[model samples]
Target: MRRLDPRPCVVAVAVLAAIAALTGCAPDAQPGPGPAASETVASPTDAATPSSPTPTPSPTEPALDPDGSAEDNLPLFTEVVEKVWKTDDRVKGRAYIDALVRAGFDKASMEVTKDRSSVGIPADSIQFSVRWTDACLVGQVGPSTKKPAAVVLPHLPTGGCLVGETRPIDW
Candidate 1:
């Protein structure tokens, strides 16, 4: 009869013991009950059932167009400014403020800059704005302002069209 080596048996036992220790499994460990059968696990199909629905805009809030373009609303803003534009060769910030106010924009939420540079020299451009929600409808008009444009932009937190200074609308 052949005798098995005790050293091989000892090494095998040591290797199994090391593996058991690393895996945190013991001979006396008990298995616990898992998830209930009634519980439905979420899958890719469940994504259709959103946890929360998209909020509906209030009556007073302007809704984004179904086409998903803010440009659809651009006409509403432009009309307000263009209706007040003068046919004469010159453009003024005051006219923009008056026109926007007449068109239902809040006067207190409007900003305009004098037709002059920061150094008090005559500027070729003048800017005006109407604060709308988180944005500003800005209008630029002057010889150098390049063909009179109106653009919508995020308003500064301090609340104005430009950084550091605006002319008071005395009228």
Candidate 2:
């Protein structure tokens, strides 16, 4: 019998497993009810299970976790970012800061970039952030970005998320 290489076979199996995982055919997949699934009465414990975060806000608002990881609060953070992006002040850094404050994120924990450049031209984008524990929830929006985006990122070694100068969240 001819000797065969095992590495190629291992790589092929890994690729297949990844494809299955992404396509939801993996053995450990645990998806929630589909759009057409019928709703039924459930025990109190099962009533509001959040298996995965929804892109849109739920009928009942999600609250910020004061001590939880930044990733856990990203859905709410993204909701606020998206909400602000739909408004007339989408490019205004202050609008993002105010909305985040109203949404219950700490004003002291936030930082935002200027809406305009030193020469007074409108900036291509604005970045805002809220520090949560050891992580930061960062958001960017404006003409350059084309769409609002939010994500959980690790804090910089020197501290804070935005570089250069950031304006105060003072009202």
Q: What's each prediction's clash count?
A: 0, 0
Candidate 2, 1-171: lDDT as tens digits:
999999999999999999888888545466776445576666687758766766885597767877778998888899999999999999999999999888889999999999998899999889999999879999999889979999988898868987778887778
Q: Candidate 2, 135: how far from true, in Å?
A: 0.4
lDDT against the true structure, per candidate, is 0.70, 0.88
lDDT of 1 by residue, 76-117 (tens): 557755665555534667777876676666788778888778
lDDT of 1 at 25: 55
- Whole-structure CA lDDT of model 1: 0.70
Ten consecutive residues with minimal summed lDDT in candidate 2?
26-35
After superposition, candidate 1 runs with Cα above 4 Å error: 1-73, 118-121
